[model samples]
Target: MLNGPLLVTERLILRPPAAEDFDAFAAMCTEEETMRFIGGACSRSAAWRQWCTLAGAWHIRGFSMFSVIERSTGEWVGRLGPWEPDGWPAPEVGYGVRASFAGKGYAFEGAVAACDFAIEFLKWPQLMHCIDPANTRSQALAKRLGAANAGATRLPPPFETAPVDAWTQSADQWRQKRKEF
Candidate 1:
């Protein structure tokens, strides 16, 4: 029901969530390492609800995390894109890739595209990535994306107890940084 823009990179395709993406989405949500900083592994039913929440954002908010697909194999790699649910600290370009695809730069590629979409199309003035303190990999990714640690912030309920650092850069800063890519 959601028809949004399709972003294609050299190795991946980023698009709105589709029904066929559920199995992979659920699998990613259930992986302990994958979900460790993302509120821990969840049951398939919980994953379904989360997937629905992501999908529903497209309809309700006109934007959400995009389902990432491997271009060559057409496999679901993960989800990455603009996300800002109610009570969010700021507009964010978040990312998560399947464990099997870790360290492959797919997350970076997809995130770059997502940042462009968020800043250019969504017209957000700033972008932020809320990362747990222990998530060094993500912190490094944020640095690679030209975002700087702006300090800490508590998330909305359910995750309010979790500690996270905010990494941010304004649209103008992103535009300047993007030219280096």
Candidate 2:
């Protein structure tokens, strides 16, 4: 529905996911560790459907996660960017890096670039991250990004009952903390 800019970080390329990215996306989604907080690991077939849904979101909503790629290797590393499904509590900037790529600070780096896009193009007055309460790593990232816990929220459908903590801040807040984002 819309053509947005592709983002380039220090060592990564953030672009919309395509069929060619399925293998990498599937591998990550099927990994237990990667799927830890966002529902359990999914089967390859299930992952395919999920991957398709992500791509479809871009067409339908004009926005969704972008496939993160390694600049030097040209490999899909993960998906990260803005996501707000129906019934979502608020506009959110979400991310997930492949296990092998985890710990390299790519998530943070990618998120900064993604949040920049979300604020600039999406023009969301505010931003939020619906993080799992037990996901300490994400909690740390949220804090680092300058989003305070806005409180709990219920996700839509299947996982609605799960405990999700809302981390949010106004665009002005993000602008003040924009030095790093």
Cα lDDT tens digits, model 1, 56-104, are: 9998999999999999999999998999989989988999999999999
Highest lDDT scorer: 1
Kindly report which residue stretches of model 2 are placed more than 4 angstroms away from their true locations once superposed: 1-4
lDDT of 2 by residue, 25-142 (tens): 8899878988898777998999988888788888888999999999999988899899988888887899898899999898998988888898888999988999998999999988
Off-target runs (Cα >4 Å) in candidate 1 are: none
Clashing pairs in 1: none
Which window of 10 residues has the lowest lDDT sum in candidate 2?
Answer: 1-10
Candidate 2 Cα RMSD (Å): 1.7
Q: Estimate each model's TM-score.
A: 0.98, 0.95
